[model samples]
Target: MTADDRRVARYAAAAIALSVAEAALPSPLPGIKPGLANIIVLVVLARHGWRDAAWVSLLRVLAGSLAIGQFLAPGFFLALAGAVCSLAVLALAQALPVRWFGPVTASVLAAFAHIGGQILLARAWLVPHDGVFYLLPLFATAALVFGTINGLIAARLLALPQGKATS
Candidate 1:
């Protein structure tokens, strides 16, 4: 494999591991998660670029779903949807000035988009009921909390000397 391929794989592996670990945690709410793996994506975005970060995020969703035995399940669809939304937002956010926008801002925007996509998908495919919208407040709140935390962590990690290591 090429060097870039190896690098992407390593990042994907790390993200998948974090995803699995997050899966094991007991969440107070069904759809709420800390999304710790996203920190890797944000870091990759800042250090490398958006394309590399997209690879990492997409691979994480695929490999993580397979590892967690959630492949082709509703959970997998939700995850895929969220990743798609997050990546899209990140891509758009990339156009902003780097000095004014950073990992924390990107993370927050992506997190909200991720949750919004999941809710929309769930309402259309999984629940098919309007009542699912009622859960928006809870999910939105969780997204804000976790997104900010993950963003801050990414920002802090980006500040560290070792954090800049690509390998």
Candidate 2:
């Protein structure tokens, strides 16, 4: 593969791996996930640019749901919407002169947007009982914790030389 294609493939693999890992992780709150795949998304965005990262995120979510047997579930649609919204946030962040915010800020914004979309989708489709509202705080908490960790990891990875050997 060409260099860019190889890079994208690598990102996609990472995202898919993380997505499956995240899905396999036990969650106290149903439909809530740590968004571990986002670490790869942030890394791709920082290194390859937003377009490539967005594609990775999209593919990851789609393939992830299929793997987890939730391909056509409301949760899958929520995830897809969340991924799209998160990418939009990332793209907008890239345009701003907010270098000081760094990947951490972008991650937080993207994470929040991702959860927000899921919340809206859940409220619209399955949780007509308004119980979905109760999960917002949990989602927010998970997003902040996971987003910060993912952001820091991405930041550190970006600092290393390209294709550096990892233990």
Which candidate leads the pack in lDDT? 1
Model 2 alpha-carbon miss at residue 155, Å? 0.8
| Global local distance difference test of model 1 | 0.93
lDDT of candidate 1 over 37-89, digit per residue (tens): 99999988988899999999999999999999999999999999999999999
Q: What TM-score number comes out for model 2?
A: 0.90
Q: lDDT values of the candidates?
A: 0.93, 0.83
Report the C-alpha displacement of residue 52, candidate 1, in angstroms: 0.8
lDDT string for model 2 (1-167, tens) is 76676767777878988888788788888766778889889888887788889878998988888888889887789899899989998998997675577888888889999998888887887677788788789889988987888888888877878774221
